[model samples]
Target: MVDVEFRVVSDRRDGLLLALGQTVIAAGFTLLRQRMVNSEEGVVLTMVVRGPENGLLLLEERLGTHHLVNSFEASPVDASVANAVSAPAAAAPAPAPAARSNGGAPKPASDDAATAMDTRRVEALLPQLARDYPNIFIQLLALEHDLPPAQREATLRYVGQRVGTWVYKRDFSLGGHLALADAVRHIALPAMRQLVQAELQDDTLRIKNSPFCHRGEHGSSCHFLRGMLGGLLGGPHGTEGLRVVESHCRNTGAEACCFEFHA
Candidate 1:
């Protein structure tokens, strides 16, 4: 078992809660219970979690995102008395700088130029591209066309899963299972700029009208969206049982991109 206490500086509880969930996922634990105790200075969040191997290390990595947390503490609980606070405190060591894979040798100028362009265009232009340009779609196409077929598909799916984790971590405090489903529905259309029709039955989720399907082609697409759904539902939140499948796609002459998510 693991117990964590976070001292939040601000009452903006939403972000802090989300950050806590992110940290919990990073620590490779399932949050069993959480309590918020109001104090004179600020709110103190106490979390009880199912422990993982190297849980302290995971928590330390995730704490970097807890900007609102003024102070934090964690301790592994003894199995005999899981609630007892007598266990030694886990103090994370200071992180060291990252080293190069090539023994610090300089990379090619052409590689550096490509990397610079990707950073400037992809990172800097993301928000504006989503609003004004079809940059998201363009980038998706570039990913597909710029690499070999297998590598391109694998890259898209991997990116999708990572983005899914990001989305789930940011909005995880929305409450129980039904509420989470509703949260996903509410965020879809506005965020993706496509009409999203969602249906939940048992553990299966069917989603149609994805933004990636707004264009036309000739085969199965929307792999990134599939990855996003997989990551959001399964990643970080202990819902890895969920799986995503794009059964229909506009690229395949379907009316829209239809994704079926099930265990």
Candidate 2:
């Protein structure tokens, strides 16, 4: 195994860390330490990772091609420093306290705050999801089982938004601005078909055999699809403030999952 230090610069910081981290893992490396800072150039990310010596080339290729990365440099770490950092720690650290406000008071948490999606975990599995396509119900089943019942719907929705935004930025952002119906037909429908069987009819989109709720046993499991639609259709470059509603779901004994769009 070899240890390497990487410095990456990006135009934005919104999901820079998560995106780069996903690329690193996909290229077969384990992240050891990381730091981020904003500079005149942009968002700078410095990370140390360990992986097979032969993996460097593949890692470089992945980093260079990543959509979120503007430029990056990677170099082998000095043996002594790598060993020192890799050594077992003397003791475990104490748990971190809640963050404080500028006034030094603990801030109360808001239930309305959107649940944080585990982008690293979700992105890592995205390739597998795409590769397997419509036959990916086993993976969706695992995700359904893993999440807590109370937060499952919200988490799936958030994941959908993340995935949808990612797809839009990666695929459709370069084109001219389109109207809602055009965007839905040209952008959203194609994107949706990548994961499920979907067809847009008028203002309604019907999804046949959605992997998330195909079994007809779970109670309305189309939260992710609904959230994805919101992300795809409501972005600034697309149509803003568009709403997606799940009118019918196979999980509720409907033949297909139906979504209605409203501006």
lDDT of 2 at 62: 90
User: Mind sharing the TM-score for model 2?
Assistant: 0.52
Enumerate clash totals for all models, in the order shown: 0, 0
> Per-candidate TM vs. native?
0.40, 0.52
Reference-based lDDT, each prediction: 0.49, 0.69
lDDT of 2 by residue, 1-263 (tens): 99999999999886566567656665767765567899999999997887888989999999998888899998889867876664434442211212457876322222332344444455444554444343334444555555567766766765566556666776788888888888889988998987777998787899986766643346777887887787777756666677788999988889899998888
Question: Measured by TM-score, how close is model 1 to the native structure?
Answer: 0.40
lDDT of residue 30 for candidate 1: 48
Lowest lDDT 10-mer window, candidate 1?
A: 91-100
Candidate achieving the largest lDDT: 2
The C-alpha RMSD in Å for every predicted model, in order, reads 18.4, 13.9
lDDT of 1 by residue, 93-125 (tens): 211111224665222113433333333223222
